[model samples]
Target: MKCKILPPKGLYHPVLPYKQLTSDNTHKLLFGLCRTCMNKISFKCKHIDDPTLNKHDKIHEIKRCKECKNIKNEKCIHSDEERVIVGTWSTIEIDKAIEKGYELQKIYELEHFEKTSTDIFKLYVDTFMKYKQEASGCKCDPKYCKNDCKNDKECKTKIQYIIDNTAYDLDIDKVKYNSGLRFIAKICLNNLWGHFGMRDNFTQKNIVLLLEHITKIVFNEKYKDISTMILDENIVLTEYKEKEEYSKPNPSVNVYIALFTTAHARLKLYELLDILQERVLYMDTDSCIYNDDGSEACKK
Candidate 1:
């Protein structure tokens, strides 16, 4: 069956408010302010003489006093550098820092920072919701549906009909909003990198089985002893096994590469926009807000 390919939809155009011309750099600045606030209110460990322990050696250490055993306690060798500081500063502190040009070394005497972070968070949520609503209104059938229409000829025909009838000239605002929302959602949901990189327990078992079979085939007499030697409870064997496992093809590497390439493409597009003399106010992974001066270059 010959399937007709539909032309891509036009990109979204957003009308940015003149008052709220903040960029992604602004959020980084706010995060820095929060970090400063966090630093001032948080305490440090007094036990600076404690020596750091190796991972295997630390496993053998017995539990001691609260200060010594607690991972939150900075004195504990197991305590991480980032988690050593405890407690958050008030919203008033953040406001004061902003007002004082982010130079506030100490926490503000008042509690102004309370709603500051929440307000920013709410803005993101609201923006995401708006775009989600717009995208949800798409009446056209999707190209593929895994749940009900896997390789169904009728389903494909219906999808093609929708695609043929659907208008490509969507509202610019809706397009921009949906794109931004998708980017934000991806940021939150694309935490699969860790899982992707993790070794499959089943795959590891299979590898061990394969090794056992090979050993038995090669050295029938000393197969058991060789197997014991190969699978010894030591770091050397463990490291070797891990190296062998990782040397095989990984789907996660391809996923990471795809994500990185997408980011690189976006960066290159931003560079092109700079050459075109456009004033970019904000940009996410997929979408960007720039001054639309009705110029041919700007439109392109």
Candidate 2:
């Protein structure tokens, strides 16, 4: 399965030697989902205790499964007889999971993954990079800049160097010796990515001083999830998430973009992990700590 778009959701039966499978961290029936697709699916597995049933006939039977859902790295079903809803995964992860002994059984697709040739953020990213280059002159040579040059062309070269390296930008290093450019850059990018995935039904808060206000809030069908806290005899704090139709969606919010961004990030991390393997000590969303044997393991 060579998927150029976002990953898919499926049920896979466990095979032998499950050490290499990307085990679901949530350990739930319905795990990671692409909110854009809402690919929530269900399956029915048969469990029989007949002694005449062979291992193959054990069809969907999982006996004394050591690792139920959510148990990390532990073998779940005793044999290939059971099929578990092992969360949504990218095709790369699916390939690795198969290599580690998992068989795909079923998949439910509510909507197809989105793909396009047009770069959505081309203008924004290009503008940001150009602005960063122009704002910082050659004199502000960041640590990432290996060569010390005195011309504007060399300054452009420095920007190119920053772009090629893993370090996001010189502003990241500027926090200590220069200004709070890192935070400024981070918030801008964070908000940019977040804007595309903002939920319409955010928890809203209201300060109530009148009895009618409390009544209006409590009886409002628009506010599906409602809660109130009284700070004073006349003052109350009411917090609730509005129903979908009643809530206003952000005009810029496009779940497809958000899903693509996240899916690509996971694949990148997975690629790094595939290289590190046993050497990986700890890993986060975009970073990792691994045991290096002085062989420049990352370069591999």
Candidate 3:
């Protein structure tokens, strides 16, 4: 939430109490996606039912959802990749989408930049750390835990405990964004915390909590009995669970990257599956990263 450019104090993406599109001036239909980047694709004006918008006073059937699959604040079942294969998106690619999405501020003019290798690296690193705490979740004292610890099998209630509770709360080394470190972090976080982005039903805090619980489960030595557990790799993932996957975007237009990645990853997952000896390999997240063999463990 601390944008490198703005670095505004106490800056968190505040949520609208109601799902009204017209609530924010930037929330209007056909408006650029500077505010809800991922939401652009999945939250198209033709689709979606944000009570906040209240545009349609007389409509029976819902139109398609335009918010990008990757946006955390928007709502959509399919990620970017799924939406592309279905051909529900516009012809715009990441670069165009970004360009088209930008709305110059009254205070500052807009500036365009190429999608150079450097920018890609920056995005990946930003994307990685952005979801790390969410993957790692929080730590907690058994007595003060408030996240329904008694109910949750994994009772991790503290997150970045050192970052927030240490005597030097204001003193910290900023985590730098690098591809090497980011990818590793993503693998770990995605498997544990799932992904967060501009989409409905997502928040920086929630993702962090999930990740904390994951680490707690591992360190607590609970999953040691995976042999008899009903776990999906790690978390009790719902079918629609995902991390970094491109979800359908809202009308915000910032989901261009998600749309691009989803389209590529989805195609690769399918094309690579046919070449594999086991169809199951296609289901693994790493198939896109490696195609050496179809072995189960190797698949991961």
Alpha-carbon TM-score of each model against the true structure:
0.22, 0.57, 0.22
Estimate the lDDT of model 3: 0.36
Runs in model 3 lying further than 4 Å from the true structure: 1-86, 89-119, 122-184, 187-197, 200-253, 277-282, 287-300
Cα shift from native, residue 239, model 3 (Å): 26
Residues 1-300 of candidate 3: C-alpha lDDT, one tens digit per residue: 101111111212211111224434454322222233433434434345557655464233344333333343444445333322111222222222224232111222322446533254455555555544333333344333334332344442233443465432221223222345446777864442223234542322212236565455445432232212235544442122223343344454344455445545544554454344243322544444435564754554
The C-alpha lDDT values of all candidates are 0.37, 0.54, 0.36
**lDDT of prediction 1:** 0.37
Task: For residues 98-142, write the lDDT of model 1, one tens digit per residue.
Answer: 343332333324322233222433554455444444443333345
Error of 2 at 215 (Å): 1.7
Better of 1 and 3 by lDDT: 1
RMSD of model 3 against the true structure: 23.9
RMSD of 1: 21.5
Q: Candidate 2 lDDT, tens digit per residue, 53-163?
A: 788756545433333222333333332223233344445456655664455666654345476644677677655544454334343444633333423465555545654
